[model samples]
Target: MPHPILTDLETIASSTAAENGFDLCGVKVFTHLKPMTMQVQIRHIGGGDVSLEECASFSAPMGEAIETSQLLNEAYVLEISSPGIDDQLVNDRDFQTFRGFPIEVAYRNDQGSELRQAGLLHKRSTDHVHLNIKGKINRILRKDVIAVHLTRLKG
Candidate 1:
C-alpha cells in the first residue's frame, strides 16, 4: 500500500509553529476560555521570555507561516504569542528554570484527589521536582504532576 500522505491537523500546525519560532505547539483542548485560553508556549534557548511586544512583533511572520502552509485555509483563529501567566508547568525542566520563584503545582496526592499546592520552586532532578513549602521542603515525582507554574506572591 502506498504510504498515506500526512494530513493530520496537528502535524501541520506543529510545523507551522516551528517555522514561526515556537519551540512547542500543542493542540489546546479546552475552548470555553472559562478560566483562560490554552496557549502555545515558545521557549527560545538562551532567549528571554516571550514578551507581549515580541508576540506583537512576530504576528505578521507567524501568520504568514500558517497561511502559507496551506493546511488550514479557513478563518481558524491563529494565536501568535507567549505562554501566559496561567499556563501550566510541564516538567522538571520547567521547575528548574523557575527555581527560587513561587509556583503552584497540581498533582495527585496520596488520596488521589487532584491537589493544588503552592510553594517556592527549589530543585529539579531527572524525575522529580523539589518544592520548598514555607520552610519545609517536599520532592514530588514528575509523573504525579498534572500541572505546575510560577506564581507571584503578593505581600
Candidate 2:
C-alpha cells in the first residue's frame, strides 16, 4: 500500500494538471536511470502526443507547487512528458475519443481462437469494441481484445 502522503500528492498533481490544461499528469520515480537521466513520462488521457513546450509549461508550476507543499519530501526527481502517439489503448474513453482513427487490437475470435486485427475505430462500449478493418470496411466486434493500441499513421 502506498503511503497517505503519496496519495495526497497524486490528488494535488491531478488537480494542478487539470488547472494547467493538461489532460493527464503523473509522477514516476526510478531507483536507477538506465536509458535516460530521469524516467518521467506524462501523456494525454487518450494517448496523444505531448510536445516539449507543453511539457515545460506543465512541469514548471507543478514542480513549484509540490516543492512548496509540506506533504512531500525531496526524495523523487520530477520528470514531465507527454504520451507518444503509439501508446497502448488503456481505457474505453480512449477508444471512444479516438473513434474513426486507426487502431490495432489483439483479441479472441468466435471460434475460440486468437487474432490480430487493425483498422479504424468504429465504436467503444464498456467491455467491447467495434473495429472497422482496412480491407473489409466493416466493423468487427471483438469481445476479448487482450490489447488495443493506437497506430500512428504517416502522411
Q: For each candidate, what is the lDDT?
A: 0.63, 0.67
RMSD in angstroms, all models?
A: 5.9, 5.0
lDDT of each residue in 114-139, candidate 2, tens digit only: 88877887887664677777545544
Please, what's the RMSD in Å of model 2? 5.0
Candidate 2 residue pairs that clash: 43-83
Tell me the TM-score of model 2: 0.60
Best by lDDT: 2
TM-score of each: 0.70, 0.60
Clashes of 2: 1
Alpha carbon lDDT of residue 61, candidate 2? 78
User: In model 1, which residue pairs have backbone atoms overlapping below 3 Å?
Assistant: none
C-alpha displacement of 70 in model 2, angstroms? 6.1
- Model 1 lDDT tens row, 110-153: 78889888888888777877789879998888788887877788
